[model samples]
Target: MVTVQEQGDTVVFTVEGWHKLWAMRSELRIPRTHILGARRDPEASKAWGIRAPGTHIPGLLKAGTFYFDNTGDNKPTFLDVQHRENTVVIDLADEEYNRLIIEVADPDEVVALFGPAAAT
Candidate 1:
Protein backbone atom coordinates (compact mmCIF):
# COMPACT_ATOMS: atom_id res chain seq x y z
CA MET A 1 0.00 0.00 0.00
CA VAL A 2 1.02 3.63 -0.44
CA THR A 3 1.54 5.74 2.64
CA VAL A 4 1.92 9.52 2.78
CA GLN A 5 3.32 11.34 5.76
CA GLU A 6 4.14 14.95 6.44
CA GLN A 7 7.12 15.76 8.65
CA GLY A 8 7.80 19.46 9.09
CA ASP A 9 8.24 20.81 5.54
CA THR A 10 8.74 17.48 3.82
CA VAL A 11 6.18 14.95 2.64
CA VAL A 12 7.06 11.31 2.54
CA PHE A 13 5.32 8.92 0.17
CA THR A 14 6.20 5.25 0.15
CA VAL A 15 5.06 2.27 -1.95
CA GLU A 16 5.20 -1.33 -0.71
CA GLY A 17 4.90 -4.54 -2.73
CA TRP A 18 4.93 -7.30 -0.15
CA HIS A 19 1.45 -8.58 -0.96
CA LYS A 20 1.48 -7.68 -4.65
CA LEU A 21 4.07 -10.30 -5.55
CA TRP A 22 2.79 -13.05 -3.31
CA ALA A 23 0.90 -14.78 -6.10
CA MET A 24 2.90 -14.00 -9.23
CA ARG A 25 6.50 -14.00 -8.28
CA SER A 26 7.45 -16.01 -11.34
CA GLU A 27 5.47 -14.16 -13.96
CA LEU A 28 6.28 -10.65 -12.79
CA ARG A 29 9.39 -9.31 -11.20
CA ILE A 30 9.37 -5.95 -9.47
CA PRO A 31 8.31 -3.28 -11.91
CA ARG A 32 10.33 -0.10 -12.36
CA THR A 33 8.46 3.09 -13.19
CA HIS A 34 8.55 6.86 -12.76
CA ILE A 35 6.76 8.92 -10.13
CA LEU A 36 5.34 12.23 -11.38
CA GLY A 37 4.66 15.43 -9.46
CA ALA A 38 1.65 17.72 -9.64
CA ARG A 39 -0.32 20.54 -8.06
CA ARG A 40 -3.84 22.02 -8.36
CA ASP A 41 -2.86 25.60 -9.04
CA PRO A 42 -0.90 27.07 -11.96
CA GLU A 43 0.66 29.69 -9.75
CA ALA A 44 2.21 26.95 -7.65
CA SER A 45 4.03 25.68 -10.67
CA LYS A 46 5.38 29.13 -11.39
CA ALA A 47 6.33 29.75 -7.76
CA TRP A 48 8.46 26.62 -7.73
CA GLY A 49 10.14 27.82 -10.91
CA ILE A 50 8.81 24.78 -12.65
CA ARG A 51 9.09 25.20 -16.43
CA ALA A 52 8.97 22.72 -19.24
CA PRO A 53 10.83 19.38 -19.40
CA GLY A 54 9.78 18.86 -15.79
CA THR A 55 11.44 16.49 -13.27
CA HIS A 56 12.39 13.04 -14.46
CA ILE A 57 12.58 9.52 -12.96
CA PRO A 58 16.35 9.29 -12.84
CA GLY A 59 16.70 12.64 -11.17
CA LEU A 60 14.02 11.85 -8.65
CA LEU A 61 15.62 8.53 -7.77
CA LYS A 62 19.12 9.93 -7.46
CA ALA A 63 18.47 13.34 -5.94
CA GLY A 64 14.91 12.94 -4.64
CA THR A 65 13.95 16.28 -6.14
CA PHE A 66 10.44 16.71 -7.51
CA TYR A 67 8.56 19.68 -8.97
CA PHE A 68 5.94 21.16 -6.70
CA ASP A 69 4.80 24.75 -6.64
CA ASN A 70 1.53 25.59 -4.93
CA THR A 71 -2.13 25.21 -5.60
CA GLY A 72 -2.76 28.74 -4.36
CA ASP A 73 -1.56 32.19 -5.28
CA ASN A 74 1.91 33.13 -4.03
CA LYS A 75 2.50 29.51 -3.18
CA PRO A 76 5.76 28.37 -1.70
CA THR A 77 8.20 27.64 -4.48
CA PHE A 78 10.64 24.80 -3.81
CA LEU A 79 12.13 21.63 -5.25
CA ASP A 80 11.22 18.56 -3.22
CA VAL A 81 14.04 16.03 -3.17
CA GLN A 82 12.57 12.64 -2.34
CA HIS A 83 14.52 10.34 -4.63
CA ARG A 84 16.90 10.12 -7.58
CA GLU A 85 16.96 9.46 -11.33
CA ASN A 86 18.68 6.99 -13.62
CA THR A 87 17.90 7.00 -17.35
CA VAL A 88 14.66 8.70 -18.34
CA VAL A 89 13.22 12.05 -17.30
CA ILE A 90 9.63 11.61 -16.20
CA ASP A 91 7.98 14.91 -15.48
CA LEU A 92 6.34 14.63 -12.06
CA ALA A 93 3.91 17.44 -12.83
CA ASP A 94 2.39 15.49 -15.70
CA GLU A 95 -0.75 13.41 -15.36
CA GLU A 96 1.04 10.27 -16.46
CA TYR A 97 3.24 10.41 -13.34
CA ASN A 98 0.21 10.68 -11.12
CA ARG A 99 -1.37 7.76 -12.88
CA LEU A 100 1.65 5.57 -12.33
CA ILE A 101 1.81 6.41 -8.64
CA ILE A 102 -1.89 5.69 -8.32
CA GLU A 103 -1.60 2.33 -10.02
CA VAL A 104 1.32 1.18 -7.92
CA ALA A 105 0.54 -1.28 -5.15
CA ASP A 106 2.51 0.64 -2.56
CA PRO A 107 4.86 3.58 -2.13
CA ASP A 108 7.67 1.30 -0.97
CA GLU A 109 7.03 -0.80 -4.03
CA VAL A 110 7.77 2.24 -6.11
CA VAL A 111 11.06 2.76 -4.32
CA ALA A 112 11.95 -0.90 -4.69
CA LEU A 113 11.05 -0.71 -8.35
CA PHE A 114 12.88 2.49 -9.20
CA GLY A 115 15.40 3.28 -6.46
CA PRO A 116 18.87 4.32 -7.65
CA ALA A 117 20.62 1.48 -5.84
CA ALA A 118 18.07 -1.19 -6.68
CA ALA A 119 19.90 -2.45 -9.76
CA THR A 120 23.33 -2.08 -8.26
Candidate 2:
Protein backbone atom coordinates (compact mmCIF):
# COMPACT_ATOMS: atom_id res chain seq x y z
CA MET A 1 0.00 0.00 0.00
CA VAL A 2 0.91 3.64 -0.35
CA THR A 3 0.21 6.80 1.60
CA VAL A 4 -0.67 10.07 -0.09
CA GLN A 5 0.42 13.32 1.41
CA GLU A 6 0.46 16.89 0.22
CA GLN A 7 3.51 19.03 0.85
CA GLY A 8 3.22 22.62 -0.28
CA ASP A 9 2.57 22.56 -4.04
CA THR A 10 3.48 18.92 -4.47
CA VAL A 11 1.72 15.66 -3.74
CA VAL A 12 3.84 12.83 -2.47
CA PHE A 13 3.24 9.09 -2.78
CA THR A 14 5.18 6.87 -0.44
CA VAL A 15 5.03 3.13 -0.86
CA GLU A 16 5.29 1.04 2.28
CA GLY A 17 6.36 -2.41 3.46
CA TRP A 18 7.22 -5.18 1.02
CA HIS A 19 5.45 -3.29 -1.69
CA LYS A 20 8.51 -1.12 -1.89
CA LEU A 21 10.59 -4.14 -2.75
CA TRP A 22 8.14 -5.26 -5.37
CA ALA A 23 7.63 -1.87 -6.91
CA MET A 24 11.29 -0.94 -6.79
CA ARG A 25 10.11 2.51 -5.87
CA SER A 26 9.73 4.09 -2.49
CA GLU A 27 8.45 7.58 -3.15
CA LEU A 28 7.19 9.91 -5.87
CA ARG A 29 6.37 13.58 -5.86
CA ILE A 30 4.51 15.71 -8.43
CA PRO A 31 3.38 19.24 -8.46
CA ARG A 32 -0.30 19.90 -7.80
CA THR A 33 -0.56 21.83 -11.03
CA HIS A 34 0.44 18.76 -12.99
CA ILE A 35 -2.41 16.74 -11.54
CA LEU A 36 -5.12 16.18 -14.11
CA GLY A 37 -7.45 14.65 -11.54
CA ALA A 38 -7.95 11.83 -9.07
CA ARG A 39 -10.54 9.09 -9.14
CA ARG A 40 -11.47 5.95 -7.25
CA ASP A 41 -13.06 3.04 -9.05
CA PRO A 42 -13.79 0.02 -6.96
CA GLU A 43 -14.35 -1.94 -10.17
CA ALA A 44 -11.22 -0.63 -11.82
CA SER A 45 -9.16 -3.38 -13.36
CA LYS A 46 -5.41 -3.82 -13.68
CA ALA A 47 -3.05 -1.43 -15.36
CA TRP A 48 -3.78 -1.47 -19.09
CA GLY A 49 -0.48 -0.08 -20.27
CA ILE A 50 2.75 -1.59 -21.46
CA ARG A 51 5.11 -2.69 -18.70
CA ALA A 52 8.40 -1.08 -19.27
CA PRO A 53 11.02 -0.97 -16.52
CA GLY A 54 8.40 -2.42 -14.12
CA THR A 55 6.79 -5.55 -12.73
CA HIS A 56 3.48 -7.30 -13.36
CA ILE A 57 1.64 -10.53 -12.58
CA PRO A 58 -1.40 -10.58 -14.89
CA GLY A 59 -4.41 -10.19 -12.56
CA LEU A 60 -2.33 -9.99 -9.44
CA LEU A 61 0.01 -7.00 -9.17
CA LYS A 62 1.28 -4.17 -11.37
CA ALA A 63 4.23 -2.56 -9.70
CA GLY A 64 6.73 -0.30 -11.36
CA THR A 65 6.99 2.12 -14.27
CA PHE A 66 5.05 1.84 -17.51
CA TYR A 67 4.36 3.66 -20.73
CA PHE A 68 1.26 4.44 -22.78
CA ASP A 69 1.38 6.01 -26.19
CA ASN A 70 -1.58 4.88 -28.26
CA THR A 71 -4.10 6.45 -25.91
CA GLY A 72 -2.63 9.90 -26.31
CA ASP A 73 -1.55 10.07 -22.66
CA ASN A 74 1.78 8.66 -23.62
CA LYS A 75 4.54 9.00 -21.07
CA PRO A 76 6.42 7.23 -18.33
CA THR A 77 3.79 6.11 -15.83
CA PHE A 78 4.42 4.87 -12.32
CA LEU A 79 2.34 2.14 -10.78
CA ASP A 80 2.46 0.49 -7.36
CA VAL A 81 -0.78 -1.32 -7.28
CA GLN A 82 -1.75 -4.48 -5.39
CA HIS A 83 -5.54 -4.55 -5.47
CA ARG A 84 -7.86 -4.07 -8.39
CA GLU A 85 -10.73 -2.66 -6.37
CA ASN A 86 -10.96 0.78 -4.92
CA THR A 87 -7.82 1.93 -6.65
CA VAL A 88 -6.87 5.56 -6.76
CA VAL A 89 -6.07 6.72 -10.30
CA ILE A 90 -4.25 9.99 -10.39
CA ASP A 91 -4.06 11.54 -13.84
CA LEU A 92 -1.10 13.79 -14.37
CA ALA A 93 -0.16 16.47 -16.82
CA ASP A 94 2.66 16.29 -19.37
CA GLU A 95 5.47 16.68 -16.95
CA GLU A 96 7.53 13.69 -15.94
CA TYR A 97 4.66 11.22 -16.05
CA ASN A 98 1.18 11.07 -17.47
CA ARG A 99 -0.49 8.83 -14.96
CA LEU A 100 -0.15 7.14 -11.58
CA ILE A 101 -1.84 3.84 -10.84
CA ILE A 102 -1.61 2.92 -7.20
CA GLU A 103 -3.58 1.60 -4.27
CA VAL A 104 -4.24 3.73 -1.22
CA ALA A 105 -6.14 3.28 2.03
CA ASP A 106 -8.64 6.04 1.48
CA PRO A 107 -9.55 6.68 -2.12
CA ASP A 108 -12.26 9.22 -1.52
CA GLU A 109 -10.18 11.46 0.65
CA VAL A 110 -7.32 11.36 -1.79
CA VAL A 111 -9.53 12.19 -4.75
CA ALA A 112 -11.02 15.11 -2.88
CA LEU A 113 -7.65 16.77 -2.69
CA PHE A 114 -7.58 17.13 -6.45
CA GLY A 115 -10.91 18.98 -6.48
CA PRO A 116 -13.51 18.76 -9.26
CA ALA A 117 -11.85 21.18 -11.61
CA ALA A 118 -8.53 19.44 -11.56
CA ALA A 119 -9.64 17.11 -14.30
CA THR A 120 -10.18 19.87 -16.78
Best by TM-score: 2
Q: TM-scores, in order shown?
A: 0.21, 0.84
Off by over 4 Å in 1: 17-100, 103-120
Count of steric clashes across candidates, in order: 32, 1
Cα displacement (Å) at residue 93, model 2: 1.1
Per-residue lDDT, model 1, residue 32, is 28
Question: Residue 31 of model 1: what lDDT?
Answer: 19
What lDDT is obtained when candidate 2 is compared to the true structure? 0.76
Local error of candidate 1 at residue 113 (angstroms): 25
lDDT of 2 by residue, 1-120 (tens): 889998999888899898888778889888888888888754443536777777788878878888765446557778877776758778787577777778888888888988543331
Q: How close is candidate 1 to the true structure, as a TM-score?
A: 0.21
- Per-residue lDDT tens digits for candidate 1, residues 1-120, read 234444444434443343223211111112123233321221111123332332323322111112344233322212222221211221232222221122222334444433422110
lDDT of each: 0.27, 0.76
